[model samples]
Target chain A: MTIENYVILRNKKLTEKTFELTIDAPELARLSEPGQFCNIKVSGELIPLLRRPFSISQVSGTEVTFMIAVTGTGTGILAKKQTGDELNVLGPLGKGFGIDDTFETAILIAGGIGVAPFPFLINKLKEQGKEIILFNGARNSAELIKLNFENELNSTDDGSAGLKGNVIDLLHANRKLFVNKNVKVFGCGPHPMLKALQDYCSTGNLNCEISVESNMACGFGICQGCPVHSASEDKYYLICKDGPVFNSRDIIL
Target chain B: MSELDFTVKIGNKLTLKNPVMLASGTVGYGNEISEFLDLSEIGAIVTKSISLKPRKGNPPQRVVETTGGMLNAIGLANVGVEKFISEKLPFLEKVNSTLICNIAASSVEEYTECVKILDKYKIIKGFEINVSCPNVKDGGLIFGNNLEAVAGITEKVRVVTEKPVIIKLSPNVSNIAEFAKVAKERGADAVSAINTLVGTAFDIYTRRPKIKNITGGLSGPAIKPVALAKVFEISRNVDIPIIGIGGISKWEDAIEFMIAGASAFQLGTINFVNPKAAKEILEGVKNYCLQNNIKEISGLTGSYEL
Candidate 1:
């Protein structure tokens, strides 16, 4: 866990509402794991006091980046940042995906800004010499983020891209991908998309791990604000600590 | 640098190393957040309030951010007292700070029973009776709102444990001082004023409540003024020590609370934004005392002039 005031190295607008911000954070860049996130102090003001949580979109040598969608005041401020502006970020907090070489094909599913953490995970999985299938989805083709993967599968809610519906429909349409193969599914997206993916994985008995989003006040386990119920137990787990990533069968979503 | 005293006495029993503590439910068991900061730096660690039986807490949409603060309807979701001792206490025992185990129950009997179970743990320095949780079904705000209920619960727990008793009061009541007087009369060592005031927010687009529980406790900088008034009121009326809570984000706020008659302070929502808030405020307090030529930090307590 590292907290530092990082200088904006780059803040590029991907779409009208989406941005990719690069910060000069050597310690955080070196320490951050895939699927883990950072809680950024959005503004110096007190009205919007709580820091916003963002996944580690990508980490290069000395720079940590986050793919931010300017949905509210916090993200709007972050998206409009000038290069060299200082921002306080506490991260690579929370548990990441359990990446091991036991499985053959890694089915990576992402929806919209959920595509943020995948670029890092792809690097790790490829380093382990694992075969990867990337499924990317957005509301429309214009909303999709461009990735460098050669085996990328695309989907748009409208019939503007590869598939006409969301990522779930795309996953369902390509059913043969998981059949008769040692496959494990990894997903991160909107709640509905992740739920649909979990349902699909549960029925097929395919191992799935998903990164969930919640209204997190603290990225660590302190302020028990973000709790997703446990599937096997009668308790609630903090998304920040127990996981932003969990086995599909372990949580209620 | 001149030596400054930060030690504080709760009634006649426990003495804290400093005046800064992590508010109940803000930091769990002291272990989960120990990786971020040294627990011993904090004066005390107030564990999440535990009930006699395990509680699942309110359903989803438990928290939503407001203008300057956030609303939480956590409903005292904790691993019951039995499991708490077996699971959470092991790590807490190793922490060097004073440990105050907060407990809440739906009934008076359950409250006493919970305290009895925790009495055997030598590491626990005190008991913080949480009668002010607004999200629970029966025990929380219901017990905290009534003076008779407040006195009844405190008296029951006071007899079972030799540790200092701190009755955490709710701010939703008509008169916070009336309840503080009852806590003082019932052998409580101190009073933690103003647990999150009951509040609600709405989703303007959906035309529905923001929180699933409909109403939740409002916390953060927004509640500081209201909490300060309550502490001021309680200070004038009650004789025992007071631990000020709610919206204390910086040292200035801590000093203001101390001057208003809070001997110690607790950090809640600020912990979410800055995990090292307590340490920063502790250092600020020492600096304030040294700069002001005050020998002890306690000199600021009730120093407000009319």
Candidate 2:
């Protein structure tokens, strides 16, 4: 990974609390893969000291985009960045989504801003000529991020969106469409949603991969700040190095 | 400018190319940060604290950002000495930088045993005994708080290696200089003053601790004044060379530590924020010396004026 000061291309507001920041970082965009992330320094000051880790939402040519939610001070500062500001970024970090030819169909599951990595993954899946089905869910219509992809289904807790339930419930209700096909599930969401998806995938005997999130100091192996328990071992795997993305069965979640 | 001496000696045996060293637990084994800047350009790279056996470290939520600092309870997670010699040393040997292995153990014998095993490696220039780590339930502060324990650990580890031994002192003490004195009297080559101060943070909504460990060592610009004071305190009371560490983020801070009594200084929390800090601070320090008409960088040590 490398640290570079990239010029901000655009900061478009996606929702009331969310924005999509595009940066002109040729090398980082070139090295980036779906599910991998970049650690962004929001300010030069030490108050918001640590660099904020963001998922690589999309990459086009020399531009890379991050789906940012103004959850705290760091991200709030990120949301206010302008078109010409320079952002110090360290990335193409962590293992990206594992795209192999093991399955013919790709079922993308995302909840809330967990939809960050899907736009990039969808582009890769398209290149492989794999059939893609996306199940997006959020709290309300205002919270849903519409990517305008083919074969897309959205769910909301309130009945203002496509399906009137969480993403997993929507997936269960529509299970017959892809259950018989050779499908692999890719999930990113809250803890409860991921747990629900893990159980669903396990009961159905499906292959799955998931992207997890954590509060990390260094978006590298050195800090040892972001750790997730290994499913098979007594040791913990660093989220920055071992994976931000891991096979569902390999990690305890 | 080329004639200006940037070298600083840490104790009688080890001389560093510059006064900027990467603090333990900040740079890990030195492979990740090496991608950002040349490690050989810096004074030294202190490896993360290693023990006799591998530690799994604490559970999730090991670090949290405070106001102007951060609190971390990493529990001294390392690959252990056996793994260090086999997996980590080979790469460090290639970096061509001064290597100081930080050793942490639950017992005095374990510290000496770890030193004994690492003493044979020619790449390792010195040892930084981590008796101040506040994360783990074992060794750490237990050995650091008691003067006798610090003296015993220093004397025993000194017996195992002829290499320079720098005792890393904890700031979470009533009188930090006393511990520095015991380290010096027990044959420690130098002392690194002001390890992280124990601090904690909480989430008001969740009504729980922010980190799983509850308490973590606080490091960043917030602790700079405290670290400078600790270095000055040790310098005034103890005759031993002091390697300052705590919240050293920039060259100005590094210079301040040297003036307060640090022979050399280690950049800790800054490494995480800016990976190229060591290289940048070294340049800043050199320019400061050249501008101030100081011929030797070491002359800044204990140059504080009341």
Candidate 3:
């Protein structure tokens, strides 16, 4: 319900299709934790009626970072935005990822662009020195994720750059690393990949957490747009309000 | 002719202090935006669509942004007509402004029920029959696209209230002029052309739909051209005044509506960006009329001809 204005301090492209936009959202940045997102003003023009929602990938001081992919005109324009331009962004919205230092051996699995969460989350988890095992999957080596698996846990591209096929596939193929150990997993990417990961976590008994996406209106829970299935309570929770982040068993998806 | 004395009358009897008014459904009883800005300054406050009975509205994810506009499927979430008359109406009476009750009905009986409830309130000077709600299942289109349906609903509400009846037109119809002519003939006092146009959005990465409802009505600058077209078409054909609205965020857009034969205008979606935008636009409209040497504000209507 709190409305604040933010200027686009920096917009840098991490890939051809994706750009990392940093806005001057001091309040949002100060309040933003790991799992929260923001609703951004796509353009100054009035044609596009609603603001687009994006996850807050990184928040440093007054700048809130958004890892946006140019999928449509709204985001395409956002990708083309230069420095010093002003973007009206509503922030630190929705429920974010939670971190606990209770575990030591943590495994991070990312699917394509789903790699967004782990980089920031892993940095926060590294202080625990929990031998983090990373499983990253991409379409082909061409679309391989550009980030080093934080602590060089383990990197596998779909097109056989480092390892072959998918990230979960690579893990199942080499099951020795995950032999009945209670390793915490965090994942975001394609739904099928996350589903497969979720299924594998259930069978393999791995404690995993996955982030979900849905129709997000007011990223702060007011609109109740982003509804996700709650497996525990058997109710639909607003993805924007309840979470873009959830435990692997907490959701049906 | 001058700003101090200019009172623009749209249709026949609906006289507004100015030629600008807030659009229906978006302002939410004028209380939503007035929390930060005053509601009295604008020409009129068009509350959200209130049906006869209290409706729960659409499921979550009622809105999404498109190329130049946004889409919404907010199925008229209202506090019902009786409650609106009892609770909201008394509050509306306190404001030094006219109330344009935007009503929606699924059936003829429901429409009459809504009017009968609203007729008791003295504050409600006008009624905008929202036959163009796009969020409901076969609701917005059923009464909107058909010229006969439009006329029937217009007449249904017209007979109940002595106040001016504004039949809100949806842009989904093929020929908008035909619909407007039907409403004018059916005893509609005036017409508000072009409610939200039908459109949608999706996340290509997720390979899934953007909005949960799958489709919603597109509003904002994206539909400005469509709204202007509907206004121009209706204004040229209908004898009554036309109130143009769609993606109207600035003075230039409002002027375009006036030139297209709209006697008055409304703002939607722009309210979400900055709550104070309406007051600023009202000021801008007054300044624009003064600067352009427009003696009468209504004189600016339908200035743009083919």
Candidate 4:
């Protein structure tokens, strides 16, 4: 489902650069799947004309929330949006994570604000009665979003949090946790972290899926802007349409 | 208030429900944005340019947001003519608006061959001759700039198809009216003015070009004024209808183009900012006609006074 010009229900600061915005898009919330994202117009003006894409973080009834990192001018303006401010949003775009009863254990990995798409995935996975083990990493403790996951572990680059290393390092240190279980890995983070996770999973011959990010204009297949090298095919796949999520073995990473 | 007539005829071959269209390349082959918009709201959907063979387009960073506009060097990536007929044309047929196929090639023969294959399909309402693309290695800007090349291609396509043939002109020319006159004389049904102006953007930190092509076509509000001026010049030179394109984000922009002698308008860069902008502008024009007591939108065409 796609909703345009939805009003913001909440826009709050999570950290210095990271913020959260909840829009009142009931149709989008109902149709949204984990790993899918939304494209938001930063402002009404043409200077910052292109809409920025954000992964869906949480959904509650008519409200859909996004975890945004103020990276550039587009996001900086988005972060400044206030409650009751109307924004043009088109969403539930791209292919989402393949979550089903096949995998008994879901090992979720995130780096920095890559944690944005996981909360909703966790919520859905929990409802399916799957074992959830979340591995999250950020620059520091303040950068990490607070969530309720009893089996969660974390790392911070500055060593100001649970584990004093990157998320991949934390995952590497705790390899035994994924050893004998019927586990399926799901990851979202910076490219390096996803690459590291892909290496670890492929090396062990484990099943894994990952969410990919690229610079995109239309959050649909049209512009052909966001492309990831296809692992099997010689052609490139659009991250906006083919996936924000793909099997770790299916993409070149 | 009396109802205002929004319908318009293009070259006596096709009559569109309205004058506002979603320009080629901006709106994908009528299917990608279907979920976000109502296709019926638009007068026509011009599919992205297709060539005789498939093109992979340019490398990443194909698009970059600039001040009040954007730059794109897509290199005319497409599935070729055959795949478009098989894969894309089916989806476009389901759309409610007129379907205009935009064709581009490196040579006159390639353009004619591509159109010959497309000419068999009745789903296409018209053909938009795309000769202004700047990203191609050859024949794009070359054919559109040279009078003989423009006339040769226009006459070739005109001989092959009975459908309306609209020539897309480049803005980088010294005197655009001369080119428009050539296209008009060669049997072009209408003219869609001012394809993106060739420009380049650089990242000061890395001292590297922002686009992989090193140069790209600039579109958006930044190019609107130039588009309007060229459209006005072309309108004065030729009696054919002009489809004004570039930086049109609102109904008022459409009105400005219509007043300047453009019979219709196409929304380009603004589609990236707001997918529904074309539909909004179409509705806005209708409301403008109703409030102003205008009987026909064509009445505004060339209505500009000194």
TM-score of the B chain in each candidate versus the native B chain = 0.98, 0.99, 0.95, 0.98
How high is the lDDT of residue B185 in model 1?
A: 91
True contacts kept of each: 0.75, 0.88, 0.35, 0.57
lDDT of each: 0.89, 0.93, 0.75, 0.87
Error of 4 at A136 (Å): 1.4
Instruction: For residues B105-184, write the lDDT of model 2, one tens digit per residue.
Output: 99999999999999999999999999999998988999889999999999999999999999999999999999999999
lDDT at B89 for candidate 2?
Answer: 94
Candidate 1 runs further than 4 Å off: A176-178
Task: List the candidate numbers ranked by lDDT, top first.
Answer: 2, 1, 4, 3
Single out the weakest 10-residue window by summed lDDT for candidate 2 chain B: B1-10
Candidate 3 lDDT by residue in tens digits, B231-269: 988878777888888878888888889998998898876
* lDDT of model 2, residue B107: 97
**Model 1 native-contact share:** 0.75
- How well is each residue in A52-171 modelled by candidate 1, as lDDT tens digits? 999998888998899999889889899889899999999888999888849988999999999999999998889898889999999997888868589888999996877998988898
RMSD (Å) per prediction: 1.6, 0.9, 5.6, 2.1
Query: How would you order the candidates by DockQ, starting with the best?
Result: 2, 1, 4, 3
Is 1 or 3 the stronger prediction by DockQ?
1
Worst 10 residues of 4 chain B by lDDT: B32-41
Q: Please give, for residues A28-147, the per-residue lDDT of candidate 4 as tens digits.
A: 989999999988888778778788889999988788899999988999898889999998887889999999749899999999888899988998998999998999899898887656
Model 2 ranges off by over 4 Å: none
Task: Report the CAPRI category for model 1.
Answer: medium
Q: Which candidate is the best by TM-score?
A: 2
